[model samples]
Target: MFLKRITIQNFRGIQEMELNLAQPSGNRKQTLIIGENGTGKTNLLRAVALVMGGSDALAELLNTPDDWISFGAPFCQLSATLLTQAGEERSIQLTINRGDTLKGIVLANQDQLAEIDAALAHATQNYFVVGYGSLRRLNRSTGFSRGGETIFRQARATNVATLFNQEALLNPLNTWAMEVDYRTNGKGLDIIRQSLNDFLPAVKFHSIDKEKGHLIFLYGSTQVPLHLLSDGYQNMIGWLGDLLYRISSAFNDYQSPLKAHGLLLIDEIDLHLHPKWQRKVLDYIRHKLPNLQLIATTHSPLLAQQAQEHELYALKRTSRGKIALEAFRGTPDRLLLHQLLLSPIFDLETDESLAVEELKKQYESLKRRKDPPQGKLHYLATQIEQLPQNQRSNMNYGNDQLDLLREIKSELKARRDS
Candidate 1:
């Protein structure tokens, strides 16, 4: 199933916002929302979880403050339109009023909706809706325990250890192997190994510490614990690993890597990621879970730019307190920093650095003067030369800065000669 659209009203920093996440025909299955801090990116993701998860979603919303009912607004409203795998359309809506509990409804064809509901209900049974917030939980593996009770709990995107253990793997693989004529355990290991290598080649899963409680990763010859890794490494590992476990747990279809179709809501998907990682994260997710509908927010332009125009949504809040989705046209990656800085997505008025902004102002000032003063012209040239070559190169707009500086110098010489 995939989400078609989501409408949010009076929620957190957003007064009203509507996002059409469905890809244009023939486009890929990824929707990326980008905005400055506090533009209700996180709120939008949380709203999706609540609407899709139903009763289980309520427990998570309890952490929201009472004042969550936007100031001067009576309540908050969140509605999502979903397209089921069977081509049926349904809409789920939730409302939260001040001094009252949140209410929700699903509107669709009864039979079609029931099937969709059953899938979601089965997801809840397997703890399937993966919510990965900014601060991901990290822990050392406490190894295997025979006779341990399997915790059938709603799975957070950060916690998938329960499903990664021997018990979880052995039980499912052995059962599948017995039913079929194939060795499922070996195949499962191969899938896990290949997935990890694809996502993070430097780190492979080390032998499980049955004697000691620790899950280790192989970095050369040394075994490293999850907590010991850098935050970026840990974050990616935590989310991607959990996602694999979820897919395996929810569906027995091993022929396809990820068989269960579920909603993946990630707040700040680029959090703690390097630029390299940011560029590849979405592609990796898409490759692994081909059918999973992904809704994610990111501040990284690298990540946002990589997505096709139809897959990216820019959330901009107007001065009057209304949030709207800005249209992203043309190929995003083709736009340089100067263009991106001015794009509606970033909404940058000037160069990111103060020195560059000053240089731009000086250039404009010199351009405006009918007969520019020698001192001002010389100063502008000197400032441009003083800036690093790469910095000046990046700051170039329609005209190259070095060429402009030379042109201004030639003009100064001609004026003196006259």
Candidate 2:
């Protein structure tokens, strides 16, 4: 199943917005949302979880119903178009009123409601939808008891609990690693290992030490437990590792559980990830699980650079002070860091200091005068030379960078033609 599109209104900081997540091309399922802090990125993700998970989602993410809807607004409405496994697209909508109780969600369309209700009821088959918040941490490996559980329970357990509820995290990977390795004859651990090692540069998950009560990894020349690694390793390992266990459990019979197709809602996809590793996160996961539709938010420009035009959406506050989801056009993969930040998506007016801007104005103003002051003009020019934009333009990357530059230009030209 896939979330084809979404319409969120009166929800948190968003007044009204719509995003077409999946297109008919099917290959354009991966979507990346970018916005400044407090632009409602997290709220948007929570809205989707509420729609997908319904009241259970509301309970998991929120406590105050009145505050759930945008302050001063009457209520919050969430609408979504889901592409089911049978290739049918169904539109479902629900709302949360200011005074109304947030017990169970009641849909506006009974026919569509019945379809979604049935799918949600089964929770094990037909379609799969999971939500993940950005709080990923592996503090310890003890206290988790061994047992078998369905994917539905596991997904919800990892969704927002990591950020909101610390008690919910009780050695998720350690709890299930031994059982999965035992059942699959080490094949399960192999999938987890390869997946982790492929994305990470130096760290590798070799195996889980049953005696240590935590998963072990090969970091550089030495080995270490999950908790012993740095926060970045633990964050990625805990998050992706838990996701694998959940999805794999759903498709335990398959040779590779990543083959299971579904919609994955993850907030702050770049959380706690290094720049090098973060740059390729989307591409790596998408390459392995092509059919899985990923809807995520981030502030990372490197991650946004990897997204196709159709897959990129920016949330910005309008002139009237309302938040809107704007689609960024053109081939962004070839844009430089500064250029990307100054694009229509980011709308960064200028990264230079006010002093530099004043210098630019003075230079322009002096040049316009009939008898311009050459001394002041020369001083302004020197300061302008120090500006980042000017420095980039005058950069000399040495002979070794020429080939890479040429290749990038050629690729950019080809993308522009398409």
Candidate 3:
């Protein structure tokens, strides 16, 4: 199931927002939601996760519709359009009433008693949506007693469960590997390893230590357990392994598990990943799983630069205490990294320190003048020299801020007008 469109009203900090997740020419692509912290990126994803993943069980489990509902509003509604594999489109709405204190689901576009049952059945599982919050820490629970299908609305009460449930921590890949070790071709464990091994050569996850109960990877010549890997690797691979496991289970007997269609929501996709990896990680996912509709949030400009046309979105908090959604136009990948940061995607006016910014304005002012401003060049040079070494290169000037300022100083000093 591909979540083709969504419109949220009075959900959390967001008052109203609408989005279209379709790409050009009917091709499939991922959507990157970018916003500053506390700008409702998580809220939007959670709203979708709650309604799509089944809110019936989740709403009551969470028991906090008051929090999900917007302030001063008696109710909140999440409207969505799901595109099924057969090309059928379904519209559904999940509403929470504050006065009555109950959750309700009904057909959004139809009026019929007969369609209610089918719609209810279709709401929960027919159109699948699985997600991970910003803190996607996978537990090393190998006991096989961890909560499963029964937990996180049967587990999307409006996404409160998915994001706030204490039991959200997922089981490690080792436990699943141990369960399916060598039986039935390790039961999709190889799907994760084989699919990602070449793509992630830095972490050579060649095999698993079946008897020792640990997923092993060759770090050069040393065999390192998943726990022994750096936090960067652990944070990334841990949730990814769990995600692949979920996809494989959901799409069993399909043409290709990775190619299966569904909505994959990831909050803060750049969490624990280095900037270098952040730049290409989304692209890698898009290339490998083109069919899976990816909805993820991130604050990294490096990650934002990977967004193609019509894929980058932003959540900005308004002055009236509501969040607004903005779709970024044009190809973000064509912009330079700094340009991307300054663009609406990041909403950054300047990638410079206040000191350098003030200096730059003055420099431009003086450079624009045709004639004398005696000893002005010396003063600018002194100010540039006073800046800290670390802040020098980040002045948003060429290679070195010091070098650029010195060039201006030298050029101005040699001027006959001076």
Candidate 4:
């Protein structure tokens, strides 16, 4: 199942918020929420967790409405409606008091308290939500009960029975290690292994390593371990692992037909990775996992430019510390956005007239300089001379400079022709 819509009021830094996911007739997928840091992006996710199930961390981090809004505000509210794979609709509603005192110190009120509790309950019942900091907690508590009984006992028993039938469980501990090894070594996950290999031919995960170590990516014979690798690579690995694990868990849950509906929310998706990788990675995710819904936040213009206008959510902070989110206006095509974001590096411009003027200035400045033995100017002069007269006239160069340029150009031409 996928979330169809989310509505929030007075949650954290957001005074009021409403977001809807695109539900095409055939494909009802997860919605993407795009915003820069502190634009209530993570708060949006927290609202989901709160409405689905009250997470204590969310409660602690997100101040009640009174703290966010002007003094004397009453309550904060959040609601979401999700469409399951079976075509079932599920709705969650939450309300928390913004102002109250714990003993004598100011704190969130009873309604807020109830909402937090209710949200946590809803999350546990429905969506398989995973946050960055909570993976270890989930891994530990997922299949075990407080009383020590395995929660998914039947499923585990069935798998164990199958293993025994195949003589795969003769040494239980060793078999478990071997199974993990196989998965990590890229043996069983055909799609994931192929995808990773296609893009990152040099990277490998070593499951047998006690620390669940992963090999440093080797691009053209360079090998760097996790500790030694750039932060971007490390971030990519973490995201990749989370994606694989979530998909695997969904597939294993036989009773849930809603397994096909997947939503991944990433905060600061552009962190650590270079601009080239930032653009490449998003394109890769969209093409490789068409079935999965992906939403991410990034400050990189490169990342923003790659996103569709409808997929973007720009965030601005107010003086009162509240955040407002809206779609970016006048953004050209996706590719243009990417270019505009990287304009500082590439000198790309959206305004053709302005770009022409800028190019003219650059050409004139380059013409006045003493010709360097080797550099961009020499390269430019060579390229310009090769152009036809009609094309040369269309360039931003002034008539006089173009004339002088042609004299120098002829000297070079004479040298070449000789």
Highest-lDDT candidate:
2
Q: Predict model 4's lDDT versus the native.
A: 0.48
Candidate 1, 41-138: lDDT as tens digits: 77778667655555443544434434556887887777778776676777766666666633322222223235335665765433245566665543
- Candidate 4 lDDT, 1-418, residue by residue in tens: 5667778887665787787665345443323344545577766765665454333333333333345442445776777776766877666565556444322112333353453345335643235443331111112121111110132122222111211122211111112222334555644433334435544434643222334333334555655544455455545554454444434443543222223345555556666677777777666767666655665666666676666546666556767867766654444243554344433322234323564445545655776778844466556666555544453322443466457556757767776798
TM-score of each: 0.75, 0.79, 0.81, 0.55
Candidate models: Cα lDDT each: 0.61, 0.68, 0.67, 0.48
Regions more than 4 Å wrong, model 2: 55-62, 104-112, 123-126, 139-172, 249-255, 349-418
User: Sorted on TM-score, highest at the top, how do the candidates line up?
Assistant: 3, 2, 1, 4
Q: Write the per-residue lDDT of candidate 2 for residues 335-383, one digit (tens) a residue.
A: 7776777777887655556786677677667867999776776566665
lDDT of 3 by residue, 78-149 (tens): 777777677887776677666544433333222322232364466443455567777765766565533234
Can you give the lDDT of residue 227 in candidate 4?
A: 48
lDDT value, candidate 2, whole model? 0.68
Error of 1 at 307 (Å): 0.5
Question: TM-score of predicted model 4?
Answer: 0.55
Q: List the residue pairs that clash in candidate 1.
A: none
